[model samples]
Target: MLDFRHISAARRLVPVLLIALALAGTTAHAASGPGASSKGLRLAAMLGSQDAAKRAKGLSALRAWGQESLPGLLAAMEAPSAEVRRGAVMGAALQPAPALAMESLLNALGDPDATVRSLAAHTLARLGPLAATDVARLLASPTHDIRVAAALCLSRMGPDAVPALAAMMRRDDPPVQANAAWLLGGMGSDALPAAPALIHALDTDDTRLIHVIAEALDLIGPDAATVLREMTLISARGNRPFSRMGAAAAPTLVKLLSRPGTPMGQMALFTLARMGDQAKPALQDALATGTEGQRAAAALLLTGIDPNMAHTLPEDLRRTLGGAIHLN
Candidate 1:
């Protein structure tokens, strides 16, 4: 019954009118009560929309909601759509605190989608101690990637992760052991309790692991004295060549100046000199009774620790150190 030309014009105008209405509604929503709630609902609905652009917008909006939107975001993690699940996990990560979302994020670690699981692990790491309860479970995951993710997360948790990381040091898997050592080393003095396991791992024939263990020991700082003493005893007893042991045990080597100048002592002196003031006390003791080589080495170490101190050394020691420094 309508004219064909009029009908065609109306059809074209329909899309234009819809777009104008959408814009007007958005503006009105920005200025009214219940607007925020309506907008949140719209975004939440878009999370499951088939359109990728709509889903992206939804995720952005939810992230802006932060803690306020956590409940809905956590609920969305179980959505049938992988894209929606991904968006929800990301949105949950944006919360100011882990809050009630910790369990949801941990559960997401087992998401069927690898990307989602990885994002979940990264988010958990950001949550720090809020997610500590899952550390053991994540470390025990059958999947290698998940284990790696857990280790990486623990590495950033500082002292709080010491117990879990120390336990991981004894894992039969070489990669797990290596990662634990690396993380413990990065934790510095906080990882002191893990020293025994790290020291024992040094006996392994695995050359690569030996380096990691040594670094962890070094980071355990002065508390490593007992292990260092044992290492010195082993080296002196000819259990291992000095060359094989000197570099890893450098921090303790300075303390051994009271002993005779073996190859280990020579290497220790060299190592100490390179360590600056950390070696001062040991170097001073070396000057008191060390052989000419040891005294010279101590003087040279003093030069690096403090050139003024080196100049103040007894004339004879300075002369000897000067001659040896040039050669070194």
Candidate 2:
């Protein structure tokens, strides 16, 4: 039984497999190489098979060839059958050499099948920094999926892409700086190398760029602790950065909580309690290994936010907090 109402909504969801490139001409070796053509034809048949086992068997053989699989994959990419083309896109990912993939998948960008195009982009992303510069160029693409894929691809490149982003940050342009910041944050802790650059970008006059940089710093969590530690709990300028920080700011807040009678301590408690679920892991870590003051502060904070979690505190910490308080 199918629900007719949900069918349109489901059909609109693009099966995002992701790939890219222009039809940069190179002779597809499998089309002419001895023995490769025969093997490639068999591979295309198995890869496009309706049976899962045959597909698995075909995929294993493709991976085993590593870079040697490139020619067959490229030849298969040109097949008249869209299913075989889609399978070729999947096969490209298994080898994932930029030298091979960039050429092998060039045809897939114009692939009429959306799934094949998406799968191609996804495979290209697996090429990491080798494909990052080209993909980063697409961040400003008018196409929504293209921009998303570019960002996703950059984020997955880890530390290797930081220097390129660090260079982008130096440009006088605001959008480029902001996008670089967003991508650095996307790299999380691997972004440590760019911290100095990020800190320097705070000199910009644009409020929007400033806000995005701050949010990006927040996304990098404690990696930006040098920045977070200095955030004034009262100022709008300072508080906004800290506010977007979620649990990453918990340790410093817990430190403020150590002096529970102070205004900073009260505000820290409120901020931690307001963070809800995001604060749990940090709070749990504090309870487990932090100083007595941190443990006590965490227990009191958790009691107001999550009584069940408060009750899970160690016997020593619970005794120190004089037992958890009732929310009511």
Top-TM-score candidate index: 2
Using all chains and alpha carbons, the TM-scores for the candidates as numbered come to: 0.47, 0.48
- The lDDT per prediction is 0.59, 0.61
Residue 20 of model 1: what lDDT? 34
**Model 1, which residues run further than 4 Å from truth?**
1-68, 112-114, 158-160, 170-175, 186-193, 200-212, 218-226, 229-328
Residues 1-328 of candidate 1 have per-residue lDDT tens digits of 0112332343344334323322322111111125544443455455545565665555556545656666666767877767667656655555677556888877776778765665666667666666754764476677765665565557546677777677776666665677678778877888887776765555554546655666566666634345655554433434454433343444345444423344334445555665566567767766786657557666777777776776567788766566554422
**Model 2 lowest lDDT segment of ten:** 17-26
For model 1, what is the error of residue 172's alpha carbon versus the real structure, in angstroms, after optimal superposition?
Answer: 6.5
**Best candidate, lDDT:** 2
| Predicted candidate 2 versus true structure: per-residue lDDT over 1-328, tens digit per residue | 0112322332233232211111111223232235765566666665556666666566666655556766776788888888888777766665656447675553464567666665665556567677666666665555545554445446556676777677677777787688788888777778877765765565555656765665565566543245444442222254374445555556555555555654445556777887777777777778877667767888877776777665576877766666445422
lDDT of 1 at 44: 45
Q: Candidate 2: which stretches are off by over 4 Å? A: 1-45, 48-50, 60-69, 78-82, 96-99, 103-118, 202-205, 221-328
